[model samples]
Target: MNVEAPWRGNNLARQIVVLSALSFMIIAAVIGAGAFGNTAVEDQQDGALSTNGSYLAPAGPAFSIWSVIYLGLIAYAIWQALPRQRTNRRQRALGWLIALTMTLNGLWLVTARFGTLFLTVVVIVLLLAALGWTFRVAVRTREPRGGVVDSILIDGVTGLHLGWVTLATVANTAAWLTTIAPASWEKAADAIGIGVLVVVGLIGLAIAWQSSWRLTPALALAWGLSWLAVERFGGEPRSTGIGVMAIIVAAFVLLPPAVIRILRLLRPSVD
Candidate 1:
């Protein structure tokens, strides 16, 4: 049993991540079954996020980001449970935050299902805050010499999670705005909406640049924006302007990290 002590020592933290993973799977299953579709009050999330829902809303394909996040989270859970990670510092710092994320995630889906758009926005914002905290911890935590496993399961995955949620909060808020904004604002809402996306997108870029140059977040953001551009350009409620702007924003958010990575590679090495 002495040999197993290290792995078992961090059971509490490990359990939190595992349970969090389980929670994500449960809610994902609910969404998959379409149990939340066409409720008495709200339409399915996809239907609600039409061209009319919010100009900020990406096309349906953009949501596939969840599948990637869910898979990464599952990988994280398993990785944390391994003997090597039980005493891992970064994993420990992130345990409770991961739990908080899973909780808020489920709550977001619940609020969405009940047609509580405002509450859904609140939950997603809280979720994003939790993820942001986790990323802070992730950036500070030290890693062992070989960090491949942790990098794949923790830093990389959580970065993507934080990135997507950052965009999601903005889009969700926009959905709420559609419900509350006056009908007279229709003429100017497009300008206001795209502006919001740009401001938040820049902020997200700054956060990711500080946290990690990993393209995980930018990739997810670009995925959503690329689809939003597609949806706006020619799909529904076509607005060549908004579509062009989204593509620009996506390129903007993605450019910094790509440039930084390239610079690092091109820099001269001290032999």
Candidate 2:
């Protein structure tokens, strides 16, 4: 199978996609940072995006990961647009999908700011799907073509994006549910939150195994889960049960890849 068949002779197309991705990244950063009358995500929709917006919502500081993600994305955009990278097969295979992810991210923020929670959820799910597709392609491409720097800017950033958005989808859906669910359901929030956390844990473990114990996604997942534990333990909608479950889920998601890395360090010839 010719790995380059799909992207053969697509240099112009690749360049276009890379430029569009960079443009979309800039737009998303602007919208996300509250530029041009765009309110913060938490401040929009009557605070439905806040930390207390849902039982599954992480703590306030958990969102700081956006800074890292956005920066990584910008770096990826610039890196992929370089003259030498313009004809790279790996970039050709990935550029269009990455552009789609960037576009979807900007669309999600726009929907969240100006549209309904339901619409925001819809856009986020789409964004997640785009990221998931990107992840699949990265896995299929397997060996990093452009070496360590390429692995970080492309694979690493994509993993972080996918992982964070995976958890965010859960929280976003929970927030949307709050609007439509019966008021009496409030009493069951803790149980529901725990169940969702368990599902998240399972998904994280699956990703870890499937990606050969990739650590970037695990880092993002654990970061988000840790903050959820912090919020539940100390913030409004406090629930010790949920907090403990969150910590447990975080640990489970992190342990597999972490242990793998430790073993590799101890036995350098294992891989």
Candidate 3:
């Protein structure tokens, strides 16, 4: 049996996808290659991280997650370049949103560089929303026997994207507030930061349960949270409670699927 996606021949999807790649590349260049001589994101943490120095943030090394995420996206870019994938059900649904995300990525970098913390938060929020929609669409369009390509391109790529952006949005919001709000709000900042971490951990639980614990996004979240734990628990300016909370949240986010799979394996199979 042969399945062909009608949208495969659609030029608009291809164009938007290509445009997204260009925008993503720009984001990379700005963040890493010093395009416009901008400082790397980790180095430019002054606007947010350096200012607030929140206990909820991960240590510097944890951010290397971006490199892996970029690699996944590049794999996706190449997959889309194939004529067969142009009209892919998942691709058709996800292409525009992916492009939108890349555009937002660049916008966030600009806002960060200019010290527009509020706008940076706004852009990342939109970016997270776009990725959420993309994930929803990917789930709706999923077909059985979708195989490795489908899993990798549709769920894997989008899941990793969504997970990372979710984590980023929290950090961005914290940064925004810390940069703008008066120092008198320091306690409130800590409360809100910890609150956001809790909420994100719950979101992770939902994703894991919904996906039956598909591992990629959870892994991504865990990676960031683990770093947060390191920062709070082990590093300077530390808070043992927040660091412990990060550890628990990370573990909670990763637990459901493992539990479910164990149950499934224990249940007797039908002949």
Candidate 4:
């Protein structure tokens, strides 16, 4: 796609108006759900993971990253809608996808807040899928030479969203199992959650290596490590060892390549 002309015939103002309006609507819906209460289901879970609490679930802090992700997305949307980028096919597509994902994000917040775990999981799953698609398209649109930096930013956001939601989905499924099934099922649910996390971490490592997605893997690994640490020390006592081990394995796989890349950058050309 051709690079869009700047200022001339740009409809950025209209785009911003629409997006701002949509954002307001989403915020209003979230507020109306009484999701702000201290003891709201999500907040209670967060508190449960606090230093004084005994539970070790990772969903609480991981979800807080959504605020940062959303801000990045909103900025990207506005940038794309700017007169200079409006005609850029990749930018336009990314903007639209971000808007859709943001809408779904709001819905997920509302559902999760109301304790509708299943529906919340479904929404987050879709949002992650959308983010993956957008990242791919954005990377494909980059100029061959300098595009890596842009791709890194886009892919970083996408990978982080994917990684976190994959964990959230597992957590949500466990919540459902614990709520609906016999107490005896808790062990099975925890087992399944840890297993899924391991596989997800492996997949994340594979993507990071294959794409040489350096910065993305760092964020993802940090997220995985923090969660594992939380589980290990936060007192849930169930599968904490497994979670920590998974982080270790993921770090061994994901970090070495990034370090190599950095080393190469620092080395002077022999010429």
Score candidate 1 by lDDT.
0.73
Q: Is candidate 2 or candidate 3 better by TM-score?
A: 2
In angstroms, how far off is 172's CA in candidate 4? 2.6
Worst 10 residues of 1 by lDDT: 38-47
Q: In model 4, which runs have C-alpha deviations exceeding 4 angstroms?
A: 1-56, 142-153, 188-191, 249-253, 267-271
What would you estimate as the lDDT of candidate 2? 0.86
Off by over 4 Å in 2: 1-9, 142-144
Question: Which candidate, 1 or 2, would have the higher TM-score against the true structure?
Answer: 2
- Give the lDDT of residue 145 in candidate 1: 22
Any runs in candidate 1 off by more than 4 Å, and if so which? Answer: 1-10, 32-42, 45-47, 143-146, 266-271
1-271 per-residue lDDT for model 3 (tens digits) = 3343444446455655656765666665556435667676655656355412554567877777777766676677776767666555556666667767666766777666665556777888988888877776676664442478877866887788787777777776766665667878765644666777789899988877666566677777888888888887677556776777788888888676556656677873511
Among all windows of ten consecutive residues in candidate 4, which has the lowest summed lDDT?
47-56
Task: Give the CA lDDT, 0 to 100, for residue 262 in model 2.
Answer: 86
Measured over all alpha carbons after superposition, the RMSD of each candidate to the real structure, in angstroms, is 3.6, 3.0, 4.0, 5.3
Output the number of the lDDT-best candidate: 2
**Per-residue lDDT for 1-271 in model 2, tens only?**
8987665457767777767866866786687678788787788888888899988899999999988998898888878877788777788778888888888888888788778999989998999989888987886784457888888988899999988998999989999998789999989988988998999999999888888788888889999999999999999779998999999999999988989978888997765
Residue 255 Cα positional deviation in candidate 1, in Å, after optimal superposition:
1.2
TM-score, structure 2 vs. true: 0.92
Report clash pairs, candidate 4. none
